[model samples]
Target: MQPMALWKRVLILLVCLWGIAAAMPNLFYAKVEAHNDAVAAIEAAGGTATAEQEAARAEWPDFLPSALVNLGLDLRGGAHLLAEVQVEDVYKSRLDALWPEVRDAMRDLRDQVGAVRRAPSPDGILRVTISNPDGMTAALEAVRALGSSVVTLTGVGQSTLEVTAEGNDIVVQLSEAEKQATDDRTIQQSLEIIRRRVDEVGTREPTIQRQGEDRVLIQVPGIGSASELKALIGTTAKLTFNAVVSRTNDAGADPGPRNLILPSMNEDGVYYIVEATPVVSGEELVDAQPAFDQNNRPAVNFRFDTTGARKFGDYTAANIGAPFAIVLDNEVISAPVIQSHIPGGSGIITGSFSVEESTQLAVLLRAGALPAEMRFLEERTIGPELGADSIDAGRIAALVAMGAVGLFMIASYGLYGTFAVIALMVNMALIFGIMSAIGGTLTLPGIGGIVLTIGMAVDANVLVFERIREELRSQKNPFRAVEIGYERAMSAIVDANVTTMISAATLFILGAGPVRGFAVTLGIGVVTSVFTALLVTRAIIEIWFRISRPKSIVV
Candidate 1:
């Protein structure tokens, strides 16, 4: 009757609609490719699902809510993925960082001794021949940081002196093992990272979780394919720049004395040539997009920060004759010569990469490099068939719960049962709205919580209804009965829902993955149920009274 009341009704409807819209994508495959697949399936199936099948489907929960929000994987088919992040490569990365120091130490030892040659040994040993016994002792001291040991010596007192050194090979081996362990830990850290990224990107109800030591399990409901998920997680995008090995005519010419710069390495026993000095680190790039160059070849367009751009320009200018290497995850992708300066801070990397490869690279870069390099320890795919079955089971459980609650409300209460049903509907709508608002994932447990909340919602309504009947039986006027019912029952409903809310909050705070998902939906349901039962349902009863000014109320 009043403008304010009309607006309240309108607000409730709009919020319910909003929740459904927000959840639609996660509940249904709204992507173009999925649409095409559904269309094809429909055409192949002779234009419709069989009447028996359609009837069975209706008996099950209908996924289409407002023609947008669809059921989650527990009601539809989807894929799951489990993969581990690789950590061995991170150790190699640390080794790469130590190259400058390793090279410098090698040269110092070589000069002090007769000549030092890199030997293929597990301990990273360098064989050195000393001109004298004193020099041999000096060379060993110079290489102390290398963890070397003087293995053999000959002509201790003679003019010609030789000493073989083997450092702490055991320590180095342990270091490699530790690196692997660190990589494993990175996978653990990455679980949160992947979860945040996926959730923010609006992948509804995705379960990104840690599996034993190094593995992660991700289940995305209604996301029926794992191709994108695989591409997102299985990436070892360790990017670095190295100076190209010198191929000048004076190859052996000593790199002129300059304050020790990164690109400079000791000339002796440094086997890997300096490919190129990286001017711009991958860290500077904020975003990457897949694109094709003028040649229509797959490439990634990258943008760098101001600092990166400046450094890149300087390196290209200084190394005009040298080629700079673009290394991705320690593998050399390109060795383009610094023919000219590239100062714009943005450039395309041209390689023989396929469109998919290029896109994958772009995604990895944009997601940012892992704190440490990682390796894929394992990978497995979950078929949609299993997800579909789970969906069916969950739907049946929810239906049974709803049916039981509905029957109990109608049979236990007389005219008041109708009001309780209306409140239950609003409660369901509010739960969906809240989930959509926060993008909470609806797991099977989450479905159970929703169903449980429906019964709880009716319980609140029944409390008020019973209070109304008491007031009416006492010979109170219809309006007075309605007012007294809400007033008396409000305190009880608040006490019950508040205690449940506290428990839900505790669960959410202590839990992870699916447990957290369940907690979120449960907490939201409790709040929404209370509001719908007390406020919306009360409003509906008031509206009914205004329409029919009867001497006696239905209750």
Candidate 2:
């Protein structure tokens, strides 16, 4: 056989060496992980590493690729929560907000509509009664004018609100298109907020995804329990600044029209009557951090965005000595009197909170509030012991498969079979290297993929070796037989691997979770196996033949 090109051989060698280097860090996972963490800590602190951290960093060389394949939740253990967003709650808030607008609009045409009064209605519905029943058509037209087009791709040209007149009552509710849009926004915002919350705790690769229209699925690896995960994300954190009109200890106090009575967070049973319209919403907050109050108590310091800052500065300037309620999730956190004209839109919130609670509140503020409340429908905690057992089982299965394959290959075709076995090992290394490079997660099914790949890795080699035996029978020349064998078997090897790769790709696109993990390993294995079988084994055989200069080769 003709020798391989020098550049081609060098390229192949370099690739193999790179794969080996990339895969090396997994052998010392804990040490490499510590080095990476130390580097991150030093960068975050803007300072030098400690002596222990320095030692840890030195355990892994900086020049080589140090990425390791992330382990999946099934392998690492974690908390899982399936939550459903209360999207209808947003509708109620939306209608409540619209009351002021509707009332103002009706007031403008008081002569035509007569007296306008807000009538109690179910959630998501707004009912306004007019004294004159004959003028309901004109009133409906005026209210309908308030309906704006829904701002969504599927809701283009559709009104955000529906207006109808029943006798003297004008009924208002969100349009179907608007409801769909709101649901979409709620789920997306919930997912993002959950992600931010989980990421704040420095958990690795926590999965927070929208399950359906109103449901979210959260899986946080390394969390102690589902309850812990819930505690982190369950709070609505709906912080708002409302102007306080009166203070009361009565739970059933009447705050009059367009006002609400909310219970205090620190003082039990004490409530405050505040305006429904917020001066600044939590959505306007740009940043928040855990801080200490002047009294040395834990607190959360927050800064608002430009618009919010201007609005807050103007409001405080106009209402000095007036109390404004800091509300969170319908509860009054505090009703502090504005002592002076506060500017710059930065403030500290002090309540009866512990250090941990303050820190969590700060995290929530930074992440922003969930659009609406979420009800956790399902919760689960997977123990680390179960994950460890799964890892052990998968590891044992893979090792046993590798050993059996290696032994079978060696017994079947002698030195040539040993070459195939070596190529198989290289194939495994390349698979892991690629996975590590891409930050792929390894699930239990992924280990099964690797084991299956071990058995299949040598199929191309076996085909070539069998063809070589046939050629040897006909030609009786080792060099010519090897060349002809590889050439003739190339088409079959390519066809087999390509078909399998297509299957793996389909699995990846159509599957989720463990199936996706299986697809990833399988797809990677197919590519690496083909490379090792065609290049590595051939290189080994050609080199052996060149050194031995055999006249005839054994089958």
Candidate 3:
């Protein structure tokens, strides 16, 4: 047998050691995972670990890699939601924003388009009537001038607003280009918000992705139910600072056309009429935390970005002794009088809130509000019992496959087959090690893929063994036969595994969820199996041959 170079021998030994070390955490999965979670919690809290947490952290050594294979929804059990975003909700907001611009532009053409009055129209349409009918064309031009070009690749050169004249009235709505762009932004923002909310709860491996233009798909493992997940993400949290016009006890009060009446969250009979335009938006908020007020009541403390701080400072400075409403999702959370200038852009929101409510509110504010409301179209909760049963079944199947494969290999070729069996064990370890290293998730189908890989892993060894038997019959020398066997089988092994890898790549690219999980395990298995079969097995055989110095070998 030809001896391997010192560097190659060391490299092979190091790889084997790494695979063993990386795969060791799985032996004590619960303890290791608890340790990792405790460390993460302590870090997130920006403090030292508690006694219990420190004990948990000490359970696993810091010198060793603690990453374990992430379990997929099928194995971990969690909540799944398919939510559809209300993208049209932004249209009215956009048009309302355009009102100020439209009014200003028409003010420039006051001589041509007489007095322009805003007439209430449908949800997405903004209607303005000019007293002079002959000046309708000029009014259309003035409104169209307020529109800017759409910034999208497909929408370049197209105007964001669609303006048309019906009789003496000028109608405005978002153009198709603008609507599409808005939908994309809304879905993306929704996905980000959902991710933040989920991550805040410290869940492992939550998948939040955009499904379509107006839909999002969320899968959170280890969560209690779909309703709980929904509660975390469903709140619009649309916080705004609107100028308070008046506070009334009567619910039927209509404040003017440019203002809005919102019901009080705390008081049943109180309502506030506020200006439609918000001085500062929650989107400008950078940080929020749960804190106790001076009166020892639960409250959410918030800090704003530079732009918001300036706007808020200016508004507060100008409106001392006047009331301003903090609006959340069209409901007036509180309407407080601006007693003094709040220049630092830091404030507390006080209401009849519990500690839990304050914490949830802070989390929502920090996560940023969803751009639009989400209606859950589909919801599901997977129980942990089902996942446990699946894991048990997969574990039993793997054990059975390993036993059968080992017995067959050992019975066929004795010492050499034992070497192949050992290589096979290393191959499986390396598969799991790589998966854990890469933070790949393991699902039910992923277990099936692993089992399938176990059966296929020995194919290269089988080819080499068969080739060795043929060479032995012709050459009559054990060392020469082994050399020729490996050389002859390399091409076939490479071709077969490469083709299978291509198939796994296709599955990973086009498949979703469980199918992709299976593809990941399968692909990793192929690469590891090839390495173990060719290098690891050959190294073991060479070492054995050198030690034994066998003149003749039995096949």
Top candidate (TM-score): 3
Pitting candidate 1 against candidate 2, the one with the higher lDDT is: 2
Candidate 3 per-residue C-alpha lDDT over 145-197 given as tens digits, one digit per residue, 9 for 90 to 100:
88899989999999999999888889999999999988888788888888898
Q: Provide the TM-score for each candidate, comma-separated.
A: 0.70, 0.87, 0.90
Which sequence of candidate numbers ranks them by lDDT, best first? 3, 2, 1
Please give the RMSD to the true structure for each candidate, in Å.
Answer: 11.1, 3.4, 2.9
Task: Note the clash tally of each candidate.
Answer: 20, 0, 0
- Tell me which of candidates 1 and 3 scores higher on TM-score: 3
Clashes of 1: 20
- Write candidate 2's Cα lDDT for 156-188 as tens digits: 999998999888899999999999988888888
lDDT of each: 0.63, 0.89, 0.90
In terms of TM-score, how similar is model 2 to the real structure?
Answer: 0.87
Writing each residue's lDDT as its tens digit, candidate 1 over 1-555 gives 122367887886676566555445444444422443454445657879655445434432334432233345554555567665555444444444443444466565554455443334322222333343445556545544543332224212222112244442111222333433455557766776566556533466676777676677777666546675656655546566667664333435554321112222223322224443354678777778889999999999888788877887788888887877676765556667888877877887778889888877887777767655334444445566776677678768877887888888878775567777767765776677566555456666778888778778887888888898999899899888888888899999999999999999998888765677678778988888887787777777776777877788666
Candidate number of the best lDDT:
3
Native-vs-model 3 lDDT? 0.90
